[model samples]
Target chain A: MIEIIDLTKQYGKFTALDCLNLTIDKGTVFGFVGQNGAGKSTTFSILATLLSPSSGTAYINGFNIRSEPKAVRSQIGYMPDFFGVYDQLKTVEYLDFYGASYGISQSERNKLIPQLLELVNLTDKQDSYVDILSRGMKQRLCLARSLIHDPEVLILDEPASGLDPRARVEMREILKELKNMGKTILISSHILPELAEMCDTIGIIDQGRLVAQGSVSEIQQRLKGEKLIVVKLQHGLDEAVRFFEDQPMVSGLVKREDGHSLQFIYSGDAEDQVQLLKMALLQNLAIVSFSEIETNLEDVFMEITKGVELT
Target chain B: MRNLLLNPVLNKEFKLRFRSFKSFLGLGLYLLALSVLMVGFIFLESQGSPMGRFRPEQSRTMFILMSFIQMGLILFITPGLTAGVISGEREKQTLNILLTTNQSSASIIFGKLISSVSFLLLMIFASMPIYSIVFLYGGISPGQVLVVLGYYIFTILVFGSIGIFFSTLVRKTIIAMITTYGVTLFLTAGTAFLFAVSMSVSQMGNSSNNPFALFFVMLNPVMILFSFLEPDAFSELSNQLGLGSEFPLWAANMVTYVLIMVLLIFISVKKLRPNMKVKSRR
Candidate 1:
């Protein structure tokens, strides 16, 4: 569990985190969505007790990050965005070193390391040098190192940033496993779709402020008046396209590659959608299926931060 | 104390340092350099002597020469050993993770310092047989040898702390090493140079006791080492500085070095966590 209250961090005139407030419940997977330099790392660093906030404070599992940093440190595992591994150490040795650093006894470390390695799907490579492993494998090793103390919360900042698609999927699967194990996870990334499939709730941060926070569909619902409708047609694609094009609500009509389906962005509510559907039926445009498509978080993010500069 | 003894950083550093071929290569090169110098000095001494062989009384000079050479090696090697401990971690981006762990700043700093100093100690201990060569001639007393060895340990501690202080202060390892060497040079050579210049300058005037000159002499590690190795060698400097017989220069040197080392360690620990504000909750 994590609760941040009015946490602000400033560097002279530049604000890295500006009076931001957020909370994540126990065993909840909260994804922090933001572009690069959008204060995601700053917020996470504060929660991890690595950076001191300018004004307010945060709490992890009832321990204040500023006051009880050691308790907060013991309760959470932090995997930084740009961490470097001890290349000279073996995978097991690396994990062991961190375990020892966390004050775990040697016997406990010996028992916990193999299980952590297996959890991250790095059992076979435990004996290999850390530098010799692939990027994905090293990421998994770092994940295991973070889990060495078995902390209740995990603050993973961009865990899958540089991974290839397959490795990203691997990381996702491991996170799913962690989710099932009932660990509260706070992960951050600039890519929306990456966290869309895995996160239970996502918060969009921009320019040191949190703009949106909710489930994927909840956020999409909050930004109403713009809905995407897909119409599957038996025929008459040109006529249906023209009909929707004539309507004031419809814009950005996209024809599907499959000859049967075409989608269009409609800027109207449910009542208007129903009226539009009635008009399409009256036109007898040979409609097979007509339904509103759920907008993904990526589109929701774009719509929310519309005029904001990226990078 | 127990925690410091079994520090995980110490364990990891030892494992990494010894496993690499570089450690062995460094040790081998170090011994080879000392051996070549010792052999050359002995050969030249034998050629200059009337009997065409080294004499017993000459072994004391040889021991003194070897001790100075060993101190020079320590002065050269300690900076390279300690000046990268923290800055290298920063460069590799591992400092944050280490800081987030349960280890306190004191643990991390002391762990790094002890580990690096232990390596330097290992090299010094490994060269013990080289010193044993002087023992065969029976000129140097075992007590004198112990005193010199103790002084060498003190020298390593002072210089190693200097390296770590700079390493923690600077963000880049290369710059940290350069600053460490710069400070070390100022301590070893600059102090002696200033002492000589001040002594010469004072001779033109009252030529009495100058506390500045006395302070320079006490701060100079080379002078302290010589005082330990050959106490009479300090007589001229001691007489000119009006130093009392009650407090020995070597004792004053110990207090000064200990004070400096403690100050450096204190600053290093404080600087290690510049942003960690620990406020106790009511």
Candidate 2:
């Protein structure tokens, strides 16, 4: 459980995070999506209790990040964006060090570490030196380190970044297992579709502001008016474009470079779309196929951040 | 306090440091240097004497030289050991994750300082058997050796704290090391230079006593060690600087170093935070 309330962070005149607010309930996975210089990492840093906000505060599992940072730290495990492994230490030793830092007893750590290594699919590499491991293994080791204390919440910043496709899938599978274990996870990723599959909800932040927040479909539904329609024509592509431009719901039309298809923003509902397609057929525009493009999380993110529909 | 001493950072540091061949190599090289100093000193003494006949008083000179060399080694090695403690963590990007754990900032700083100093101590202790050569000469008492050991500890802590302070203040390890060496040089040599200049100025100005010279001389660790090792020469210098008979210069020097070490440790703990503003419960 995490609650961020009106958190503002200012570095002189530049506002890294501006009066932002967010909340993630227990057992839910929240994905933070933002471009570089956006406030996602800044927000995660604040919630991780590493940086103090200039104004306002956050709470993790009912512990105030500002007033009760130690409690907050105890409740949540944090994995930063970069891999921070000590090259000289073996994987198990590395995990043990973090476990000890969290005050986990030797017996408990001995038990927990094997379970953690299994969770991250790093059991065999337990005895291997961290430096010798591949990037993916090191990342997984970092993940295991975060989970060493069995914290109720996880704050993972770009955990899947820089991994190869297979490693990324492995990471995703581990996250899915974590989701099943009922851990409240806060993750951020540049890979939108992977995040869409892993997160229960995604929050889009733009230029230090949370522009959109909801499930992927919920965000797409909110931007329903901006749905794009692709029309394939056997002939009279120019004529169809002119006809579609005259229609009340059609705007932002662009001809396909292939010269056979065109797309336009369609604001009408399903029935209205059918009626418009019927009119195009009646005009003898030689329409071969007409379909609406399903907006994915990437589209929603772009639409929100580009000062388009969500703004 | 026990938890602080056995903190995970210290344990990890010990493992990381000792597991490497470099530590043992460094210790071996250190002892070799000390052995060479002894052999060279013995050769020069025997060369001057008839058919290697030795004077017992020369052992005292040898002890003093060996002690000064050990002190120099401590001063030279302490900054290199400690100046990278925190900054290296930062470079490796592990400091943030370490901070996010339940370990307090003070524990991290203290653990690092102790770990580095412990390795230096191990080297110093390992050299004790080598010091048996001096012991066999019968000029230096065991009490004097213990006092020298205690002085080495104080000097190590003082210089190590200075290194850690800079390590916390700066981000780059090389920069921290440079600054640490700079401060150490100033404390050791610059203070002595300032004392010389102050005494010269006092002599030319017809002033019998200069507080500046006294202050500078008292702050110099080398001068303090000399006060204990070569008291007659130190007294002449002390008298020239108008030092009173009320307090031993070495004790006053240790107190001054203790105060400085405390202040540096305090500042280091505060500055160790990645962000200066680490807010806790109101």
Candidate 3:
């Protein structure tokens, strides 16, 4: 659905985006994950045609952004991170305004506005002035504006940011519905776990470069070689960890937190892990709970960037 | 189809111009001022000598001058009002949303220009009664009033277009406003200043020396209105200047005004290119 080649954007001495190359397939939700100042917004702005890339080319569904911008614009819905809501305009009028910009007929826009409001779960607020809306409501209204023309692709930058948990959940549901509608979605967000849950594929960027790109399981498996497991116990966790350190498969045992919880770096087969658990049980160690630790996105992200700022 | 693109801009303009108490007060105050000027004229006329406020037979001139003052107010307010139209959108972060739409840049620029001028027109038209009362004085012609009002509208549109063009070019409203004010000042006032300086430079070229010396005076909108009222003054000045009238005069004035407007609008459209893409980049 989209292709970018050697996309480099520079603002004088500062290289905001560096020779970035990416290809996104149609009908997929792609999560763009990076720390703050990782050039995520820069990349999105280039795609949205809000900012010109200092170098490189971008294509939207085969339409070159620089050449056939009108066609590309007509097919895409873009929600900026920081956008304004016209205070006096009704939610429907706001949608109508954008639809008119797209050359949608008045009757056509009227028909679409109600459906879009419903899709964004803002049907009741359609008659309300946009200014009266909460931040989350306004964000949803922005999303509705983007979709007014029934765009084929959605590029949402930080759509869930500043949203309350419930609002975020609502936005997630709406995004899932969009994904199901077969629209290609590209979302840039700092919330990694949410992206991990929401995206079909993910790209990790650091210092204006893509450090990794894959599904959650693929990224997790790639980092499992240096897997970390932190075990919290009910009490006397130190004695259990000391005994766990002596086990054959347990290569490293460090007190993970305040000497009560221990992190084990184990290199062992499934049977070796069972044996270690048996050894811990054999000792008079109080095991509050024990289970295999799953690697969360935070650890993988930290490992990937090595704590370097992208900008 | 283009009308659809312009409607939002028009609607926005109308809403803001009429809804705000300030706009209402401004328009009402303008009406009050024009009426006061009329009342002053009649009160003095009743006392005889026709008040001698201006030329007696040139009551048409007074009417035209009244409209000219109204036009001046519009010209001033337009730059201050619309200098921030586009740049303010960018500041508020709403411009990006507007740019990404399928609407062409031409539509955006045209819509904004019309919207700004619409507000100016509302204030100008609100003083229609004061203008009509000028006919009560018996020296003013209705067709002349219409023509002068036409020129006033044209001038306001030209000035408003300049304001909007600067709005798009500058990143901040203050800068846009300052640039617009400077340009307006230079084009209208500076032209007269240039004429005066040139006329003063030569021993014979005093206001009497050169017919072409008054050429720059055409740039001043009020001078043109004045000329229409007192054409003999132009000839008398030309006689002193010792030169024949080679200039197309009003034809030249019309062409210049139209050309200025065209240039301002063209530059505005160019500045508002529909370049912002909506699709997310890879």
Per-model DockQ against the true two-chain complex: 0.33, 0.39, 0.28
Full-model lDDT, candidate 1: 0.87
Candidate 2 residue runs with Cα over 4 Å from true position? A229-294, A309-311, B274-282
Model 3 steric clash pairs: A47-B281, A48-B277, A49-B277, A207-A310, B208-B240, B208-B241, B209-B241
CAPRI-style class, candidate 2: acceptable
Which rank order by TM-score, best down to worst?
2, 1, 3
TM-score of each: 0.88, 0.90, 0.84
| Real interface contacts reproduced by model 3, as a fraction | 0.46
Native contacts retained by candidate 1: 0.59
lDDT of 2 by residue, B52-98 (tens): 85465777888888888888888899999999999999898999899
Q: Indicate the DockQ of the complex predicted as candidate 2.
A: 0.39
Each model's C-alpha lDDT?
A: 0.87, 0.87, 0.78
Better of 2 and 3 by lDDT: 2
Q: What C-alpha lDDT, on a 0 to 100 scale, does residue A34 get in candidate 1?
A: 87
Residues A24-114, candidate 1: write the lDDT tens digits.
9999999999889889999988888877788888989999887788899999989999988886899999999999999999999889998
DockQ for candidate 1, C-alpha atoms: 0.33
lDDT tens readout by residue for model 3, B1-282: 647445666566566556678877877887887888877866655555645444435565567567667766766787887798899888988898998888777777777777777767877777776778766666777777777778778778878888888999889989999999998887667877876776776545333455445577666666676666567786665565564677635557778878987887788776675344332243
DockQ of 3: 0.28
Which pairs of residues have clashing backbones in candidate 2? none
